[model samples]
Target: MEDGDLLSRALDFYGLPKKFDANLVRSRFRELSRKYHPDSGEYETDILFKELVQLRDVLLSSLQNDPFAILENSKEDPEGFQFYKSAKQKAAQAIEKYFQFTDGNPVYLKKEDNPALLRLRQELETAKNGLEEFLEKFPKSIWKEDTETTLKKISVWFKD
Candidate 1:
């Protein structure tokens, strides 16, 4: 079976989100492993238990490596990295816009809430947090420099 098919099946089996969440995946794995372990006696020498072990290994290995790096290094697809690069660029643009909207100011104005500004502030925080999560997940990403630069600019906006 293809890698994508395997990944899809694994995600479905574990009830994991489509997006990779290391902590969530690990937690789920622990829970399932405890129940399905060979010594757990939950099932007696079954294919399902073996399948779970295999699935866990595959998912963990995939998460441990930089999938983008694999694509970039593949001889079959010379330009495979383009898709990921474009995605990073788009995410960066959204983050930049969020920072621009905040303009280095607090969301509150004169101790009264401006609903519109408050909404924008929330959006900005979400965008920043998303980018931060991405950075943590893909530490060796090609977009690291740009992402870090944007994060630094956003941080300056919050200075007291």
Candidate 2:
């Protein structure tokens, strides 16, 4: 099936409305999972449960990159969306790297200077710069507010 079809099927399978939030999707998935889970004894087989897992992953991944995206008739700006998604991934990875090295406590980042942390910081700076550029390039993008909000949060950690 096509990507769009997969998303639509997932929504239908979970009995979710076209316009729904991540929490709603997750909640519905959990409830259904309990019913279809192989170990739940509610279903004799795992086939339906496995399918549910895949559908849940597809929906969650879609939400992660594009929260505003819906199976609507209007088309989205693919180029801008791809760029924003890439930049968002970079920023998220940088944050994860920093946290991994810092043991989730950012206070140590200010006191210590290590090669790994320095590299992670540079990567984050690049992601931050990319996001700023995205705002300029896609001035009318639907993701503008989200990109700006992400930049603001990143700034909080890098303020000098």
TM-score of each: 0.40, 0.49
What is the C-alpha lDDT profile of model 1 across 61-156, one tens digit per residue? 775443343333335433333434433444455456655776766555421444444444454454466456556666776766777776676554
Candidate 2 runs further than 4 Å off: 70-90, 94-160
Runs in model 1 deviating more than 4 A are 65-160
TM-score of 2: 0.49
- The per-candidate count of clashes, in order, stands at 0, 0
lDDT, candidate 2, at 122: 80
Q: Would you give me the overall lDDT of model 1?
A: 0.60
lDDT of 2 by residue, 26-85 (tens): 898889989999998499999999999999998888765444344222234444776676
Q: Return the clash pairs for model 1, or none.
A: none
